[model samples]
Target: MSNLDIFVGETSGTAMLILLGGGVVAGVVLKRSKAFGAGWVAISLGWGFAVMVGAYLSAPKSAASLNPAVTLGLAIQGGIKWSDVPLYIGSEILGAMIGAFLVWVAYLGQFSAFLTDPQVLAQQPAEEGLVDQKSAPNAGPVLGVFSTGPEVRNYWQNLLTEIIATFVLVIAILTQGLNQNGDGLGPIGILITSFVVVAIGLSLGGPTGYAINPARDLGPRIVHALLPLRNKGGSDWSYAWVPVLGPLAGAALAGGFYQLAFA
Candidate 1:
């Protein structure tokens, strides 16, 4: 595929991935949405469907690699040329940001109401310094709609959780007998990939929301920082690197192992 095709495909696919995936979080977490408090099963399935839809739509043009971790893993395994990796990663990030922005727009009213609800404010701790100092403004609870956070707040453990979850993800992708493009699994493989995602969420998502993709987490986190929602809170920059680095590290490990074991 041409560079333009790659850019457009990745961007559109990743955008859709984040839109439906992040939209589920907003629907479940926001105060006024019909799906509010729908819980983690809903989130896991929603994200699985989101992956299926995005990959189906974007696979033709650029193989629909919506995750930078996927892109890097494929490159490391020689499924993709090194020269094309940057384009794929950039497009995924841009698409993720766009998808996140759309989620804010789609849930505008819910966010407004949630931010202003007295109970929400009342729930926030009176003291700020007690929390992660880097996340001073992140004391607000609603940020989880746009990004992942650790339930336990242990950096090493949180990082390991992301790594292990992502390692499972990338390894599955490599062994799935899907198309070689690394942008997507084919039709049947798409279904398999979605199921894999659901399994990861059901089995391993407890700790840090299973941020197995760098673009998926960072793009929305960047949007969370940029949008002007009232009481929206800090982007939790302190915890951001864990998701990004852990996924990448996991992907590298998967690629190296694939070379040694399967390639």
Candidate 2:
């Protein structure tokens, strides 16, 4: 693929990934939505379908690397050129931001109602200064719709959880999810990868929401911070680095393991 193909494919695919993935969380959590309170099963299945759709759409153009962690792992495994890494990652981030913005647009009324609800506002910290300090620093009320956060406040534990979950994801991709040419996912591989995501969410998502992709978490978090939503609370900037670094570290580990054990 040329640089343009890589840019367009990764951007569009990652956008689709976040659009449907985040949309599910919004639908389940946001007030007045038909799917409200649908629970975790819906979220897991939604994300799986999101991955399948995004990968299938972008596979022909840029091998459908919708996550920065996936791109990094593939680069380390020598399936992608080093020179193209930046384009892949940058496009994924851009796409994720676009997807997040679209989610906000799609759920505008729900977001407005949820944030402006008197009871919901009553739970917020009285002082704006306490938004990040005394209030939830790990996540805002609706922030989970945009990014991952830990249920517990321990930084090390959260980081470790992200690393372990991401390791499982990237290792599975490196070992069994790639196509024969080693540049993209085959149909079977895409199905396997989507199910792997669902399994990870089902088993490992409780602690930290399983942010196995840096762009998936960081890009949306940026959008959440910038969006003009009332009573949105803090963006949980303090916990942001954990998801970013942990996933990259996990991808590095997976790439090295693949080189040592499976290559």
Candidate 3:
């Protein structure tokens, strides 16, 4: 258990750093290219790419859940139509599972390579992981917390993080895309989301691991329990509800807020 603790703890911080690093690239790269629209599409695609790159680099293991509350918020906003949301959500889960599978496979490779190398595992020092590392800042007020990771593993903590993350994400998208300053650039909205994610991860992702994306959390979590790998053990089914419920709850709140603010 101590070995696993050191092992997992060592790499935990890597997740958020890569997440934000990818976001920075997304912001810088997407804006300059025409592959995606300039404003909201840019940002959505920016986030999507951020998710993809984070997933890619973190391959053989599930990358962090990119944006949990936003997925629920989009579902709530009807952005993912009623008829399509189920499929969207399912696809999201599948995508997340696949990403995790790859990342874990990669992780397992390193694990396999080191299974006999006690020295390697033992030498991995503390205070060297992403959990404590400094990352890019999210400008949005509510979003800055996302970059910090979640507070606790509790359902409510996850839920509140989701609420705030979603609220900020939506607000960022709205505030930027709808404005003269941001609307001109399509990805601005998504850039806004990316930073919001960074914010939440940096400030709020302590417990429950700031599962900002339901698919990112549950999908890979399910994978962790299912994959036939060495020393794989029980998955935390008890806390599964946090990532799932928190985002949805937050999205609902965002909807109310969105309605009142813009409607």
- The lDDT leader among the candidates is 2
Cα lDDT computed for each candidate against the true fold: 0.83, 0.86, 0.43
Rate residue 75 of model 1 by lDDT: 84
Query: What would the per-residue lDDT of candidate 1 be over residues 75-152, giving only the tens digit for each residue?
Result: 877767889999999999999999999999999999899789888766653221112323345545666777787767
Candidate 3: misplaced stretches above 4 Å?
1-49, 52-68, 113-154, 177-185
lDDT of 3 by residue, 1-263 (tens): 13332223213323433344323322322212233123323333344455434433322222122344543454454443345344445545655555455554434444344323444334321121112112212111111112222323345655676656556655554444332321111334434445665565555544434455566566656665666644332454555676677666766677667667764
Ranking by lDDT: 2, 1, 3
Which ranges in model 2 have alpha carbons more than 4 Å from their true place? 124-139
Instruction: Rank the candidate models, highest TM-score first.
Output: 2, 1, 3
lDDT of 1 at 77: 74
Between prediction 1 and prediction 2, the one with superior TM-score is 2
Better of 2 and 3 by TM-score: 2
Angstrom error at residue 116, model 3 = 5.6
